[model samples]
Target: MFSSLFKRDDTFYTLLEASAAEARNCAILLKDVMTHMGADTSSQLDAIHQSRRKHKRLTQEVTERLCKTFITPLDREDIEHLSSALHKIPKTVEKIAERLALCPVQYANDIVSRQINLLDLGTVEVVNMVGALRKKAGMEHIQDMQDRLQHIEGDGDKMLMDLLRQLYNGKADPIEVLILKDLYELLERAIDRCRDAGNVVFQVVLKYS
Candidate 1:
């Protein structure tokens, strides 16, 4: 009876993991979209659309579970915040794909590639952080993952700055400049969304530690 009183459900953790997985899926699709710079992006956009739908479903599951569960492992507010952050990632990635599809740019550099790599890496860390909630999570371990997310976000900022500098160097076509600028900003925002999710996990660990 005593053990039952302290028993915690793993459903919340599973839902969070599913949401993180969707974010990773979105990143993968975004990376694929970047690889085929001038090719048709319809398939990639469809994949991201599917990923966004999956994420939305998982988030809704979490919300509905929250309403039913009397005792959650984590605070209600933290769960909602993290769910919202995870959803934003794929949503932003979908927007990026849509923009690229509307106005395809032929770039000759690896700036976008580097950003996609960082965004994917950051999403991976977010996944790890979310999974940590299932185990006897160590504050130090969670901090390490959070640190990785922060590093990715910082690198994204530096990369965007350098890319923008090149864009304004009066060499590339003005139309290309406009398209790349929009895509770069969206990618950076996606990375920020990853960071936001990581921070929520970190805060939850801190609160429960």
Candidate 2:
């Protein structure tokens, strides 16, 4: 499974790793914006957007490789599906960062921080799962990481509920409520992107294992 996937170096694996790294970077940038909401984060937000664009290019390369190359490290449809899934993690994170940039600093709190932290963990797991294709990792290894990603996503969901509980407590400003709710949902969706990508990696491994 491992040797056939990439021989530790190839265009598909290389591009997948690059896209996964960008996804991880976008997750971290989103965390930074939440941690420093009071400060100017125009540069950091711009970087998040760039990561999304970079992933788009990588995905396009995967499609081009599919057309030009005689064979792929994995099935063509699997490569396309995984590439598309990997790109969504950073793409969704970009949206979350945009929402946070406009949100008031007074609303930022431990819950949002913990949620973003989980999001970071999720993307990191995604990077690990993708890299496993080139690392000769056992099926158990990737599956374990996939399980962890799912756990992180579940934690994010719990935090979302807790945030809703706070927002609906009736003492908060209506406008603040709407903004934070939007931000919370976006963060959860970002976490979902990671879990979804990890699932794709897991399925691919299962096919070749």
Give the alpha carbon lDDT tens digit for every residue of 65-98 in model 1: 8877767788889888989988898899889778
Looking at model 1, residue 187 earns an lDDT score of 87
Please give, for residues 1-209, the per-residue lDDT of candidate 2 as tens digits: 54544442268889999989988988888877777688898988888888788889988998887777655778779888889998888888888888888887888877888888998899889999999987768899988998899899988988899889988999988998898899889889989988899998999999988
lDDT of 1: 0.86
Residue pairs with colliding backbones in model 2 are: none
Candidate 1 scores a C-alpha RMSD against the true structure in Å of 2.8
**What's the C-alpha lDDT at position 90 in model 1?**
89
Residue 38 of model 2 has an lDDT of 81
C-alpha lDDT values of all predictions: 0.86, 0.86
> Which sections of candidate 1 miss by over 4 Å?
1-8
After TM-score superposition, the amount by which residue 99's alpha carbon in candidate 2 deviates from its true location, in angstroms, is: 1.2
